[model samples]
Target chain A: MDTIIQGKAYVLGKNIDTDQIIPAEHLVYSLSDPEEVKLYGKYALSGVPPEQGGLPQGNIPFVTEGTFHSDYTIIVAGPNFGCGSSREHAPFALQVAGAKAIVAESYARIFYRNCVDGGFVIPYETSVPLTGVIKTGDELKIDIEANTVTNLETNITFTLNPLGDVFSIVRAGGIFAYARQENLMAQS
Target chain B: MAQTITQKILSRAANRKFVDTGENVWLNVDILLTHDVCGPPTFDIFKQEFGPDAKVWDPEKVVVLPDHYIFTANEHAHRNIDLLRQFASEQSLPNYYDVGTDRYKGVCHVALAEEGFNIPGTVLFGTDSHTCTSGAFGMFGSGIGNTDAAFILGTGKLWEKVPESMKFIFEGDMPEYLCAKDLILQILGDIGTDGATYRAMEFDGEAVYSLPVDERMTLCNMAIEAGGMNGIIAADAVTEAYVKAHSSKPYEIFQSDPDADYHSVYRYNVRELEPVVAKPHSPDNRATVRSMQGTKITKSYIGSCTGGKLTDFMLAAKILKGKQVTVPTNIVPATVLVARALECETWEGVTLKKIFEDAGCSIALPSCAACLGGPADTVGRSADQDVVVSTTNRNFPGRMGSKKAEVYLASPLTAAASAVTGKLTDPREFL
Candidate 1:
């Protein structure tokens, strides 16, 4: 848990579904095998219809061709982000592609759970839509301790909704870690 | 305290007398379902977190159905099935339905009902989003990610925030042309995709009860599309008859109290509703089939957990009895049981299989083929810029195969009728 996280932003429109996050075709690869796992990163957000892949101008790829990682580590989007599917692969792909945080108006429930429970990316909800304010390739900083995101390009700051009940789980680095700390799982 | 049916079920699962909406509780899960797509990773995480030799919380309580990507030549897909087999064997799990075996089931959601795993008053959690389909049987069923599913696999328990309930009442007799697909699409159009987020949708009224169990499953199956935590219909004699016919396991029935509270209630008259479709790119992008008529389509697909059931096929068969499809149409059953039923079940004294074949429609072997744009070799996958009218749920971009393609999510009636004209056609045109 780094309190201050900063990176280039990748902005997207509303209802960025699981299929668009990681296309169903690329879901066959292993999430654990180090070599196979890179495929997840290579194809992350590959189904976003290209024109809608990146915000503002669109047609910008989230991950560059032939690379497993993305230069943009923060994703800023509109409401109802990650609205379809329960594939944990959605968030895993984003994390594998080097996304550190997501600032959106809201999220689909299962996707939100997967983000925290899997300790993949920090899904932060904002009261205002950030997709319009942040441009792809714009620098952004997320202060987890302060619960605010600042656009380094515009020097504008926005308040993010508190992580609330799931914050401890996210802070503990996922359910398994939290469970162990709370002694919820029996020792082997 | 007057609690909604969902609250009551959660209360029972949490071993508490009452559970309030918005409060989190650790629930004793009745069943944890998984399939090939998510099962391998979930099993891997289970081993990584719980140790290599850890046994499941309860073997019988976990159901693994290998349906997705089963027929694909993709080696990774095959490897996933092998992993499921390895894990199931290591844990001595009895509910494992392996591919290439007699016990193989196609889609996990529909198969859960056919195999008697969906019992009322119980709580089910699965790795697949459509697991909420089981909630049709007056149970609490919701989807979770691999982490939560693996947690349940290891502990038989997981945490959940009790959802507020939303009531939907559909009155009057269900019209012949309108099926559950239309009714659900109507709701989606009204509420939009994320309207019911973190809420329980309860279906009621004469029309809902008049529907067969399979139709009810259709209503609940797409609850996830609305971002609903679960969709439930109280158990009636019809539910009991179906459950009794399928399983001998004892179960409890629960219902919402007469004075229960709901976040909101929506009312509709079945007579006022018409065949509708969720136009391409989004499930909430709904339009009346009549309004979208004459829209040319390249293909028609009828299959998946949502639309591949026997009742769905029966509806399609009614419209395609003697007509020839002008476009390529694929009929894939959700389960082997459904495939067998198509051979025996008759419409106008003709078996559905013969009807589809005679109508020039291709009937593929059962499994979730092309519903999710599987491997390149998947059947009925949409080609570049191809427009498809499909009975399957979710018409999201690239859902069937090609990102350039578009899909119109409609009832089997609409899909079949549209297939006849190679254009989006209202079922009423043929009915």
Candidate 2:
């Protein structure tokens, strides 16, 4: 059963780097306690730190703190969702942060597969013009079975297919569950 | 009448057939790679995907490098290393690269290129996205997920949709101290991070002709950082010189036609670029270091698969002579060879290793160690207020340690200068 995250899409218009998605700092940190590592944590506000001058003051609302974190599911990105190191910790953090699936105009192939393998839904090919279609807080439904996303507020229905069987493994709750069911020996 | 290098390679790999635009198809994988952190899971899934007696799809096509766990502070990482060793022995795979006696063989991509595993006219994929780093040799390479990596290991093949190609024509000479690192940073900053997503980046131009293979590699390696498929240069005298110097194995050359189709064209007159930097939290954020030089860095690291080359070492050693690093620095040569080359003092006037170590810069074994903040490398993002300038790609927050930390991207010279001053200063200041 594909779950529908009933919240508006927090959209980033362009140029999303992997560093911002799952920063290198969070890579080893998540191994200790994944729940603590949110994809867009408090640092999203201040451009990451005092050193980087933080984010734009008005953009604080866009940080995952006050509003971005509440019930958001589908992250509609411009393109190239996963572009940096082929670090699996990337998609792992995205899944841990409660991102149900991602709807992008296009996805980095490694990122797409990592999303599917990590039990997070990432679909693309632009079923609809991503530009101007999504607004923050527009409730959306993603039916995993049919591999389609419906923007309830805008009445926009987008078609997509998960990245092959990797989706099935992820849908089963990470690769561990799929491997366990299939008698796969997961590393300790 | 015109076929791009990518179309030609993908077509040949796909049974000598011609491919048109927007066709949903899968192409053959030329090379497959795995590292320490990602290998255990792959072996586990692969073993389950096929029964015990399952022979590998093709042993020669696979490459295993124990880079992630070359050394680790945790026991779990140790156990993973053991498991990888067990997997290698059970399969009788010979291409497996453990931390051998070789010094310069650290990161898989660097080691592969240095040791001549990456050849021209082939398709390559590594579990690491930086696999695109090998594309400097004129090969099609990509980074893939574990599932795809596992599938390739089981069946010795993977699928791909033939991608669009973009032609980058560069003209003029690259300035001194302005190496391939600057070229890549410039491209990433201009095109945006996702600019080349799913497209084959073909590096062509007279300025490109001026770049050495390693510099070209930095360009190709960072291709994936822009969400590109592969970054390649049309084979030329330099490539031929590289192949002749590096390998005795016979290989064929791959080229593109003059009228080859491109999704778009990016023409840069080398005379046009200025020093550039990708601001923190994203790779595409661009500005001149001159614009943002007001900030200071607590740490400056100048070695990785990206910057830890012989020339990189020579350049660093030359600059750091009689100079001291302002921060606690570590110039980790990604491979034993680069480390040894630095140690030998053969190429430069000063011993690079001694200059680095004498200046309180420790030479740690290459293990993608500090790059990910494990053990001795934990960045105090929340703990320390110091910002870091690094030569390694990706300046995501807490990349060095704490979430509150800052990372500034720059060339080796810039990083070396920052290391000396504990601030984001230019190499010219030190010189």
Candidate 3:
């Protein structure tokens, strides 16, 4: 796990549900097949209304057309991000699209758990709203150890809530790895 | 040692005398539910973590129901069913509901109830968010992601944070126009989408207790819409009767202590509540059906784990008895049993199925058709810029297909009334 992560930001509004992150229509694809798994990246966040996709200016696609990976790697959003559905595919799609971390006001429990338990991406909760302050494409760096995210473009840093009990699990990569680390499961 | 029903249930699952709210504790899961959409991926993870030849911790404890994406031409969707069959065969699971067979069930959540998987004092975890629907049985049920589900597949246990419950007491008798859907929507409108995040929503009061098990399930189904960990109601005679009718398994009932602690308490009078709809793109964007009346709609759909139950159909049948729909309306039963019930269940000497057919509504084969806007060929899926009034939960953008399309979530009565006028109509108009 990377302690210091940096990337361009993709900002979105509140209540950005799992459906929008990865539409149900595309859920039919196999998650384990190497070839088919890439499709998750292709359609990541494709369900957000065009006018609210990338936020601030809006209408900006998170994953560019005719491509699988996204240019922006960090997501900054309003409260209750990933508020609907319990699809692990949402965070998996984001990770496949190159997002490393998300700094939001809050997140739905299932999505949050998926992020850590799947080792897909780091979910960071901010004390204050970062949507208005951080524009899309703004270069940002997250310091996991310090629990802070800095907007390199504006040189502004925001404190994030501590990862607390789940940090060790996150550090181990995912629940399976964490279980192995703690001898909770027999290693195959 | 006062505790809410949720805490008590968790305590029992944890093998503890008491479990404090916000305390993370490992629970012995009684049942692990999965469906087509998530079952395959979960199996993949389970195999990857556990050895390739390793069997499930307990085949009897795992319930797999293939409902989503059924009846679609999409090869991937069909492939998912094959994967489920393969896994079930390998694991020798006793509770696998396959598609294209008499054993098939429409939706996982509803099927769980019909198959007697829902029992009070038990803990259930499913890959689908609507798993909370089982909380109506006075059980602890919450949705988990594939990773967590996979963990449970290998071990019959998973850790969960004890949720501080929020008490919602609905006073007065439920009016003629109101159903469980209206009561839940009323709460959504007040609390917004994230109102109950990481918390238990315990429904109480005389009005809540008066509802049948099916209606109680409706109230709990939408708890996820409010970001609730679970929505629970104490098991009473009604819940007990329903459980006993479906299963011979012995079960214990638990209730919140008199001095139980709660995160918050909300009071509502059913007499003052009205039929409501969650308009365009969000479940929290609620409006009274009367206020949204005449809003044009191109389609009306009644179905899903949330709204496709027999009781929901009964409500719709009452509204569509002798009326012709002005738009394309689709009636989808939540499960195979529900589909059969529509044929046998009657009101005023007319079966529920005939009521919809006579009203110009198309009754589709039971499955989660168009509720989540599945495959391109999904029945009742919305078209570009199409406005639909549906009995399904969630109206997020592109939820029912067509990114430009809009969905208004309403009760079966409101959906049927709206179908008659090709617009959003209050159920009170028909009642």
Candidate 4:
């Protein structure tokens, strides 16, 4: 895994819940079917409309029609990101929607673990609020080893807490890979 | 060194003498739970990661219950249960509770307790976030994703970080109208939704211990709403009696040291606390019921792992005994056992279900109906522009049925009373 990552930032506000990430209606999809799993990417953030206390009206889709976009790789958000539901689909949907990393003030515990264990996305915790500092389409560079997120658009830098052992799992490409590498799983 | 109960349990699970907060360690899981909503996905991951020939590490430890979307007649919803049935049959799992069968359990959380899987001083993980509800038994209960659950399914172990502990001591005598639900809402209001993020909320002191185990479960059930890793109470005589009657599993009871270190300590006087409600859009947006009185409601829901326990219905039945609900009100028992108990048990002379039915409330089957805003046919789902007072946990936009519908979260007393007046009403007035 690269120690430094650069992408365009998409900003969201506080208390972005799992229902908003992927509504209960979409939860009926079968994960075994590749076609159904792809629907998660398409419906990612589907519940977040102006009427549902999300981005004001007429906002562009974060993940356009389930197609991964290299431009929208980073998501910047305020505190309590992924606040409701224990669904790993929230992070999985964000991953399938082309989110390489998430920079938030704080995250709900289950979402944080899901992102790390599933290698869905790199979760970055920052003391400084990122929602106000970063904007949509801002070029952002995250340096994991240096514990800093630099906004190339404005030339401003923000400090981030090192994820410690969690970074090791991320570098190994999810928990299954890490467990295999560590010989935690007995060879069949 | 004095260790908190959270620390003690983690150390045991990790097989270490001591584990500090923020340190990650591999933990051997004791109990793992999954339901219809997440079970099929977890099984898919299990099969994808581990070959079809691979068997579960321990079939007895993995429990499968179809609860969340089972009440609906949707084909997709029924398909999830079919997958679980197939998987359980293939694995020969002894704990699978199939829907519409003699072995059917209602909600997974309630079933876990009734089946005695919530043994004290053990680590419990579930696919649903409210898995923290087991913490009422003094266990380290937390929610895990499908992938992690799959890993545990195959290997019987997973890695976890030791969380810091926050002690909340509720002092003074609790008021009659106030339940554990009100106390927790007050705590949520004092500390915002993320106040206890990545930390354990250890509830204790006079007021908490004075309540019944069912009510204590309600407190732990919503700890996730505050972003708490888990909510726990030390196993005392009350807990021991309940566990002994429900389960035969051998268990060790653990307690926090007298001088254990906590990240922070909050002391609340329950005597002055009033009945509170979590207003529209947020669980932490709490206000006293008295202040929010007369806010009209179009529906009333009294069910979920959080508020569908036997105690919750008993309280609601007390308020709705003779009065008819002015709006559409739905009463769902949390489990089949609870449903049977409701049918057989009576407060004065009338059965609990009779009390609810006589009050013009529709009693639904024991399932997670309308809690997560089920299919179009789900009972008690609010219509667009409708306002509902529900006993379920979250009240976010579109949480029930329509994004345009508003939801107010309150205790069963408040919900039942609100159903009578077609608005938010204080339970004390009816009492």
Native interface contacts kept by each candidate, as a fraction? 0.82, 0.55, 0.87, 0.68
What DockQ, on C-alphas, does every prediction get? 0.76, 0.33, 0.75, 0.65
lDDT of 4 by residue, B1-431 (tens): 78999999999998988898888788889999999989998998898889987799899999998898877878888999999999999999999998888999899998999999999989999999999999999999999899999999999898887899999999988787988899888889989899998899999999999999999999999999999999999999999999999988888888999988899999999987889999988999999999999998999999999989999999998898988999999998999999998998887889998898898989888988888887888877777898989999998878887888889999999999999999899999998
lDDT (C-alpha, whole model) for all candidates: 0.94, 0.67, 0.93, 0.88
What would the per-residue lDDT of candidate 2 be over residues A63-97, giving only the tens digit for each residue?
45543243455667665656566766666555555
Q: Between the candidate structures 3 and 4, which one is better when assessed by lDDT? A: 3
Candidate 2 structure quality by residue, lDDT tens digits, B59-147: 87778887754565566566666776788888887777765444326778888876677777777878888888888887788887666
Q: List the residue pairs that clash in candidate 4.
A: none
Best by DockQ: 1
TM-score of chain B of 4: 0.99
Residue pairs with backbone atoms closer than 3 Å in model 1 (clashes): none
lDDT of 1 at B27: 95
Instruction: For candidate 1, give the DockQ.
Output: 0.76
Q: B278 in model 1: Cα distance from truth in Å? A: 0.9
Q: What is the DockQ of candidate 4?
A: 0.65
Per residue, candidate 3 scores C-alpha lDDT tens digits across A44-108 of: 99999889988799999999999999999899999999989999999999999999999999999
**Lowest summed lDDT over 10 consecutive residues: which window, candidate 2 chain B?**
B374-383
Q: Can you write out model 3's per-residue Cα lDDT over B38-68, one digit (the tens) per residue? A: 9999999999988799898889999999998
Interface RMSD (Cα, Å) for model 4? 1.6
